[model samples]
Target: MCAKQDDAGAPHHHGPGTERDTDGSDRFEVDQEVQHALDRLTLLINAAEALSSTLEVDQGLRRLCRTLVPGLADWCAVDLLDDHGRLRRIVVEHRDADVTAPGLDEGLLPPTEGSAASVARALLGVGPVLLTDFPPPKDEDDPLCLREKQLFERLEADTAVVAPLRARRQVLGVLTLARTRREVRLTEDTLSLVEDLAHRVALAVDNARLHAEAQHTAERLQRSLLPELPTDGPLEVAARYQPASTTARVGGDWYDAFVLPDGAMALIIGDIAGHDLRAAVMMSQTRNMLRGIACDRKEPPGKILARLDAAHHILYPHQTLTCIYALVERLSADEPWLLHYAVAGHPAPLLVTHDGETRFLTGGRSLMLGVEPEVHRPAATDMLPPNSTVLLYTDGLVERREEDLDRGLARLRQHAAALAREPLTTFCDEILEGMAGGGSDDVALITVRTAPPHAGPAVATP
Candidate 1:
């Protein structure tokens, strides 16, 4: 038998200043309606506040399921449509959340055909459906509906309200609120409040989903822009990039290596100022501009960076960048590798000798790009041991908020010296694993080690 839900009881109408009709029912009815309206408004406000607490769609939905229990309904479940339009039950909660949670996690898909949980119809803009009674016993129920009926029977709920969760006129999911133990059935007024609540919840969920999708797209673009290091060369190159774990969007740290016209290999590592889509775009443009200048000009690292600095106003105005540009060349087979590089507002690269000695290549220092374009930039050259490794990295490699930059550099030097005897690829990875864990910044590292005389080509293992 269907039970009719009643509003909250009004206070006694025979108080001293209270006015009443002859039958004395008018004031009582008006007070009861006012109380019901206040309760509905409170429920709506609480639901909105709970759902707005998180930007993670699944977490928001879970909170939404839990928020509307016992006070608003005995059970609440949300079914969201996946990309391919399949209905998936993402959250299910009850008045007694712990016990009913396992049973609620059936992960069943709602029906597409003729069934009460017609998610497809709901997506097509159906407002809400209120069911007063379950179908006849012989009618088979989909797994989701069957679970709902089982919960309803267990909780002794005789009424159910299903509404579309919509945002900006687009239906994103379905919201189900069922009442049990209370004889108060969902009336028209209550259904209207349910629809409003569903609308607010949908807005939060949609915002979170859009953010996740944008991050995914940005990361894919980031991966595509990063180049693979060469496996066989006079200097074996290994690289690693680890984005900040705290943010969803990709950062602007990048590394590039290409063979120059003079048979010398050029390596560049840079980081732009921000960590969003605009920063990523600027990073790509700056990298490409540097590549063009580096290749076409056939100049030393210092000159190329100077020219890039001069062009910064036209290319990326008011932007800041830190970069290390270096050219690796060996004149003859008998001599050691000659390393010539220039730096602009970047952390000094590290040189770890085969004998386990480590020092930062601190000689090449200049104002960062875009700081003073016409300023004369200086270049530095070092005679690297045949088996020595040079690491060109972004500032994230040796920067921490808690310590001084000099201290972080000293720590990195010590670690590099300890791992100097390992293979080149392993050496690079070990340094990254050690340093990249604690920071909330992007890290880009390029490690190049001159091959020992007649040594086989070094493999790119990163």
Candidate 2:
């Protein structure tokens, strides 16, 4: 063997019979190992991204499982310890769609003992467990082992790895990966990689659970802050609050219907400008303030909203919102109802007849509340015949990012007209079902129908 150096003092190692680095099997093996390492690093990066993609627990877990199946294993399963300390299988994802595992559906499994193997041991914080050439449990074996055996046989698993999903020095759950082919077996050497992936999974699951809990709490508080519709009244009323499609943010939409001291029925719908706990808290305060002012004064809807605007400006500066205020009243019980309403930077109130005719109340329009405290707002009145209905709603019901505002308005009109002749309860429900897909924002709507006892659209859903 011989080596020659060029003028640059570097060995060329070219030409026949000259010893070269490329011909050695050791060098080839080293190159293969480097490529394999690079590939594994890429896979791990993808898994992390998939896990953190969504704040939905099951969906995010499914993504992570998908990243593992057929890439690292034939299938994967995730078992989590619930709030009650019970072990529940939340995901069992298999690569082959044709393979059916009878007992592998996500559900509760029997208690895991401290001495159990693999998944159970991992749950007990025993670190990663690798199983090779495993055997199926007998019929009378430990319940947890029996379940695992059933899964193993169904998928024909020859090698498996179970690792604890750990975060903050605590084991939150367990991740299991099973390989059906013996040649592509998982060994103790790969336990480090599997355990590393499990840690990322644990963090994502923890974050998603926290987000869901916060969303539930905020929505519950918002619901509690809302006013209950009057059960005893001549007007049949129904109000609904639909949260946004994603619970990532708290909504500021609200609806209120209450009777004033002077016997006028007050109807209100409003939407504050933010999407956080602050907006929700402000909604409660604003609703209470408006209720008090409406009760204290005998003014029409416009005057009442003007007073509310002034108060909102003084208390919560730089905040803006849209609102509609209306008072339904008449001189006596026998007379027809008169709807005295005012609008402040809100959608027009809809009027639908018993015969399925619909129209938007474009009168009494003014800038939305919180804009001009001293601005003179106007009010409009419309006489409602027996069995007629009036609707007030937030922008969420008729607003889509990609479509024109007029198109959404038209969709609302079409749905409202078709549902007009239906019972009040039916009308409310069907309208929501029909129009909810129009936008992704939070929605709040109030419907008031005038009717005689046992005759008109005042039908209620108990």
Candidate 3:
């Protein structure tokens, strides 16, 4: 009757101090101990991988929680301090989907000082705390305390480990774990493992915060430097820009449409070669230089770019870029509107007709800016068909990783043609909605919509 005489089909447990302890039969117990050690080692390895999986904080933490639940512990909860010095409950996870306590959604928590002593101590960077049986919160009036009480009642709380996530002499957050069964109390060994995990989590959180802050500052600076487009013009102009998604990868995509000293409207879109802050700085320098040269030189698109290339060669050497500089104008009322443009190692301009036909403006091509200053950058001209739109864009709009360059070009063309008949803003919006979804590269594009077929030699407004 002792332990029901365990058979091979059921798990066997040898009684302590029975014949197994002193005789040669103790080999089985030794084997069990070795196997348990191996399992713990495996869990630690997996936890490290999960924590370092991504630079995104919430995503990486969720991965870590999944690696722990139902295996390391029955429940895992992480609370992180924000830049505003507020404690935010980032995630709460349980092995079973049905096991949830009332008012247990993730959000900002009440000040840790008002909560249970264990949570308060952990947040203060006091060493790890082992939580066992405790009296129901003395004052359940506190939201944080009340929530913990509810969880204890609902999950039949047994044991828990609370550790401060500390890195660089500061506590960034706290990690909490709990198990329901009382027979297997979380021991000191478990406490050591939890502290190691908290250390890893702290470093990851710090890196993610730094990246986010940098990205925000860079984007704000970029927007501030961007020039406003002309709202009232015969050629209805609209532009769009989007930054790359990689962490801390910012800058280099820009678009501008404005009037030069003369009567012609200047259209410009370009991308500096790299995707870092240096790339962004060069982009601003290169863009401002081009605008100045265009205003003072009074030349065609080709010659204007020649000046840009020369100026940058002296001012910011060793930097390269792809660009399109075009002027859309008609000398007189009886003349047809014309587009004169030049491409400097840039993607060909796309032309979408009023009837859903698409074509690339492939003439006027030359090397990128940094390569050669003296080469004659060629120029091309095409008459604007009534209501047709010319789309100028950076490579990001028509290029992607591991895909043929032609394929991205074809995708852009297809999306542009389908939206050809829509309004100017909608056409640009839909094109972006269709082509720029989740692209990792930065993008800048300008849509120049001409007046309808003309009464004179030029296409005229109806």
Candidate 4:
């Protein structure tokens, strides 16, 4: 049977060949060839559309399979090279509805050494490989040859083409297209078209892979920089750090909770000026400096931040930072938690009572860090009653462009009051979802609820 054109103007070939004319005269060979080219072009356009359909590497590769199989080829497979240059069959698919072998579910294939498969040769970066006929199964007991024989038999492939998937002039993977009972005559023009399609697919796959790797590395570094909150005392601490969602830029927001040299605990949240790798690096530096100064000086939060303000000029000049450094101290579990904190152009910490009353702790506000080292930042004190929650956060939590800062603060207090009785993790999550969801800036928050004597030990959430 022949094919017909769909509403989208793309030819849909059921088995191959063309439908006879009404007069029963054969169509010109050149016209048939032109129709085939147009059909292949439409398929290529659809394949390009699927390139950025997903950011995941595996899903992006599989999208190529779904786009090509049953339309341009009866079978399609993608083989990618690992970091160690080993061939991994990432995707394998056929037009048969029931056939499932040689699919993505199976693991890595054997190494490509001494293999007759065109996929292996294409990976060598020489050029495309076109096989008009399937080679006879080898007599030797080589595992790859036996595997190739099995694949050929199962897919009933009569012809195949393997093209290199390259990025930055380096081979990253191989694309294989196979034909079964309805043979595809891959002339020079058709081979060139397939190679062009493979070109676009390779770039998309490479870009996705690189992006995933970079995001993973950044996450690892960010996690390493954020130390665990203390969970062994009267204080229950929960902290969260979310990168900006608007763009690929990594922000500088960070939170830290650590024990001072004294018995007191220190909580710090800060944001450097920029939103890139440099800002992230500076954020780590500033956080460490504040921690070290607090531990070594054994002073109140204000003096430690003052020291950081001075040292910031020497360590990383021409940069600005906003931070809130607070120290939690108590003689015993029976007493209420005493919070001594200092802020440098940062949002005031919120104090939520156990009974759902909420208010911002608007004391000790000062100029942003590195503005002027000579200006001494003062400290303020607040007595957080047992079962009260104190929230330290960066401005990203309550600074939206659509409204005034005061309005954002009011909204935050409203939601926080409603969620005051929830667990620390749930409390932080709900507040973030309610207030900071889809905000352009990065967010860093630390919520600590003073546990009463009856309650068990404090817990920390990631």
Candidate 5:
């Protein structure tokens, strides 16, 4: 009976050992699965980081090809369709090898005359398309596909996958990958991954193209708005328009000088509110109105602005404008009086004396146009001596966020004083250069100097 009991206990001892072995095997399997998932997640994160860092489309394609091939496929090539719907090979990569030069030029495979590529072109309409089990045409043999098959034969590949890249439903390019049948068969999972990558590439390319187009348009508009400098003049004028640092925010800042009917020169500087197409449109309107008023009215600065204010409400009831308008009349042999200037919520004009002194012409202050119309009061007048220079500009010159307007004014004053003794043209250039260094807001400067009696006629200079 003791021997029987011992035998039963021996089997019970083995039961716990068996349970321990099972638990260890299960834990080992769970750990291996967890590690595989972690590795895949890490690889995806790294690839996404690489894709996001690039702005150049070609460099981005190369990076993408390097990231996908070997890990996802043995070979990969990106084919982009031109504007004419012709497929053009762009980027290509092979496992542990550089791209073959002739392969890129010869590897372009179109819609195979009437196969899946043609069907995709018709159905997708330039958007992303995925082709599975795509075969060459039944009738005439395709030279391109034959070449591709030969290439794949060398790589021992039996399956091919292609995905079109698209943005806003417009096809930008196509991505193709080939894999050996022994390593992996092309499946839905592989197709979905390629689609996602193509989408990202398309978005990046579209953004860059839009940015370039906008810049070109802005530059062309700026050139058209600014008139060429007068042919001959003693008064040299130079103007520069610097766009805002932030992309998509080009504003309206302009300067103008032309002879009035009365033989006096009219100098105008203004800034429109905000930075958009609306601001640019309003700028054009305001400038034309002021020019018309100055030429037709031939009145004092005060009366001209009153007319402008009335026109502003009639034309643009909801918009506003800030301006400094001055009329320079040659009074005597060597003296000029800047008659009847007003500031409608704009920066005061800067006056530089012949003795190298600078002062702000802070005269009458009134509400900006389009706000309310009242009897426009005449601003205070200051006489410009011979060789003296008067500078009129927009408030973007003296308005910084961290610093107060006073500080900006002080900085302008300091620079103006240093340039007071220089030629009016030089002074204007120096002021613009200094302001550009600080920060670029829209800037416009107009400089007019009183001519001496012996200096003869004052011609326009730009």
Candidate 6:
């Protein structure tokens, strides 16, 4: 016997003629085992990397199919349940050198009534599945059997192994791998490896799905909470809400505009402290309370916010909020071009003149709402030129990870200056779009452009 070193550096004995003998059968067997282990490890590592690389569902699925095909199977396909709970074939991978797999051709695939997908239904339970044995088509005349045969021919698949990609009892999708020839049966170890890969794929799919669903929900809620722009007025309002690329961070960033009972147009924008259900609820309360104060007391912009700050301190002592509340009123009948407003604990509203000049109304700074309410003061007395556009937004518009708030404000001023010639609606949307790229926070921009006296009714732009 001859001794050989294991992976842990421990000495292990090999049979006779195995020591330092390249031609020995024992050496060959050991080499084959070590090579198989390495291959399995490589496959596992690649699979994990592929799954962790992206949060996009379609992209992840496509990568998963590509990872498995031509390496572990002759063909791979993933069928996912759509919004209607019907299984839709989303990705198909084939190991053909001469031909590409079919695209999303709905006609080429049969419905999920009685198909291999039915086998995947078993995954709705616990543990992984290994369906090694499958019955042959009962009859050539059967439509289901014919469809299955056609599908196999198209992908050049023979024996198939179906695994359910499940996460926390939710069936995300089904992963199917098939061989090109019936004689190429899958070994137990190979099936086990594939099952493990399927579990990882399931987790990735679940994460992506959850993210998309959350974004969709957040967008809907944000839109609903946002006030609709006024139809008839000298004030032109445009608002846009862009969520951060990170789906989990979606929250209560909102803009509001309406004509107060005193005839002054109220423009308000605010951001809650956190990005969760708590923030959304707080935002709703704050907006409603502000509206009530504006209507009942007909208070000045500064006083309304001060009162709101006091109330919030009493209600939510631990939470914080930043807001810009401006009450716009025409200076006089003849001076339709001049508009006056106020601000509090928020980004200074930008004043963009018709001549492409941009100005920030940074009169002063005050404490954010709900923090030392009595000590905080609201800034007042800012005016805009006629036909001038005033942009009100949350701090998210000008706050970046590595950059200071001043730099963000300067960037906004530059963009607004460039877009000053554009329509108020278009300019507002463009500014938000430009500033919202590359890991920026959620942005809420409200542009109120004082329309010329002769201009038509005001319209709201997204």
Inter-residue clash pairs, candidate 3: 336-458, 453-460, 454-459, 454-460
Displacement of the residue 310 alpha carbon in candidate 4, Å: 5.0
Model 1 lDDT, residue 391, Cα: 91
Question: How would the candidate models be sorted by lDDT, starting from the highest?
Answer: 2, 3, 4, 1, 6, 5
State the lDDT of candidate 1 residue by residue for 105-128, as single tens digits: 546575555555435457667868
lDDT of each: 0.80, 0.84, 0.81, 0.81, 0.69, 0.73
What is the C-alpha lDDT profile of model 6 across 1-462, one tens digit per residue? 467899999998776555557567677899999998898888788878877788887777778777777778877777776766666667777777455555732222444454443333443543344445445566544554455456666766556777778787787667777787667656556668877887888888888888788778877776677777777666777888777676555677888888876668888888887777677778888889888877887766667788888888888897888888777786566655434444556777788987889888876467777777776464567656667788888777788989887888889999999998788878977887788775546777788887665776677665
lDDT of 5 by residue, 97-214 (tens): 7445435434345553444343244325443333344454454555556555455556555666766678897877666777765557766656566666667767766776677678
lDDT of 4 by residue, 1-462 (tens): 555799998878663223345223444666787997789788878887778787776777778788888887888887788888887878787887577654533457777788766666787785577777776656464555666667767778777778999889889888888888554655455578778988998899888878878876776777677887776876788988777765454768899998776778898888898877888888887887887788787887888888999999787777889999999888775677899999999988999999999988989989998788889899999998778899988888899888998899899999999998999999989988998888898888998888875788776776
Per-residue lDDT of model 2, residues 1-462, tens digit only: 466889999976766443454467678899999998997898899898888788878878888888888898899998998888778888888998678442447888888764254678888687788888666554465788878887788778888988898888878889999999878899887898898888889998888878888888878887888887877667888888877866544678999998787777899999998777888889999999999998886898899899999999999988999999999887887788999999999999999998888899998989988888999999999988788889899998888888899998999899999988887778877888888753578888999988853553343332
Candidate with more favorable, higher TM-score: 2 or 4 = 2
- Higher-lDDT candidate of 3 and 5: 3
User: Model 1 segments beyond 4 Å from truth?
Assistant: 1-39, 101-111, 114-124, 135-144, 147-158, 183-187, 240-251, 313-317, 351-359, 383-389, 396-441, 452-454, 459-462
RMSD in order of candidates: 7.0, 4.4, 7.5, 10.0, 8.9, 6.5
lDDT of 2 at 415: 94
The lDDT, on a scale of 0 to 1, for candidate 4 is 0.81
Cα lDDT of candidate 1 equals 0.80
lDDT (Cα, 0-100) at 10 in candidate 1? 42
Among all candidates shown, the one with the greatest TM-score:
2
Model 1 vs. true fold: TM: 0.79
- Off-target runs (Cα >4 Å) in candidate 6 are 1-38, 93-108, 114-160, 166-172, 178-189, 337-339, 376-378, 402-407, 438-440
Q: Model 2, which residues run further than 4 Å from truth?
A: 1-26, 101-104, 113-117, 136-141, 247-249, 437-439, 453-462
